[model samples]
Target: MSRVYLSLGSNINPKHNIREGIATLNLRFGQMQLSPIIESEPVGFIGDPFINLITTLETELPISELSSQLRLIEYDFGREDNAPKFSGRTLDIDIVLVDQLEGEHFGLTLPRKDLFEHGYMLYPLSLMEPELIPPGQEKTVQELWQQFPFPEQKLWLTEL
Candidate 1:
């Protein structure tokens, strides 16, 4: 089995959608390691705040098939294929890392670029796997979190 990390976020009906998303993932993947749910301001567009979190699961499926399944899950939750990149979403799921695999596989970038650029991605990942060294990177997740610029983008754990 390959260990896969995924980032999930939702702005529209976030509390409900996020919970539903997780439940769906759990049903499909059997079990998952979930980070604390957090709330953050929308990054690229004007919209409601988003509830975000990261999850890790073990899967026997290949990256291509896994990515395809995730997209289908997002669609089932009302994600629009043509929606603007920065717009609000019902559910947004991205493959952040898949074991030690690197570069692009199935058109998806491993160790997603957002992991370095967004606190929403890095913080939760660090929480889940502090010692994890992403593919092609020497720094551990904890190191990246420590180096993250504070006060740049605000995010807080949510009770929801």
Candidate 2:
């Protein structure tokens, strides 16, 4: 089985949606190692704050199939079909890391670029797997977090 780390977030009806997303993922993927859900301001657009987290699960499916299932799960939770980037979402799930695979596989990029750029992605990732070094990156997630460039970007652990 391949170990995969997933990034999940929601802003629209955030509390309920985040819970539902986690439950659905648990049902679909079996038990998971979940990071604390965190609250953060929307990154690209003006909107209500979002709650986010990272989850790790073991899967027998290949990267492509796992990625497909995640998108379908988002759709089941009311994610808009053609939502603009930076728009509100009921659920947003991405494959942030998949084992040690690098570059693109089956049309998806491993170690998603967002992991390096977004606090929502990196912070929880650090919590879950501080020692994991994403493909082509020399530093661990904790190291990345320590040197995270955006001093102003912050994340708060939520009760949810």
Runs with alpha carbons beyond 4 Å of true place in candidate 2 = none
The alpha-carbon deviation from the true structure for residue 121 of candidate 2, after best TM-score superposition, in angstroms, is 0.5
RMSD of 1: 1.1
Candidate 1 local lDDT, residue 157: 84
TM-score of each: 0.96, 0.96
How good is model 1 by TM-score? 0.96
Report the Cα RMSD per candidate: 1.1, 1.0
List ranges where model 1 is wrong by over 4 Å: none
- What is the model-wide C-alpha lDDT for candidate 2? 0.89
In candidate 1, what residue range of length 10 has the lowest lDDT sum?
150-159
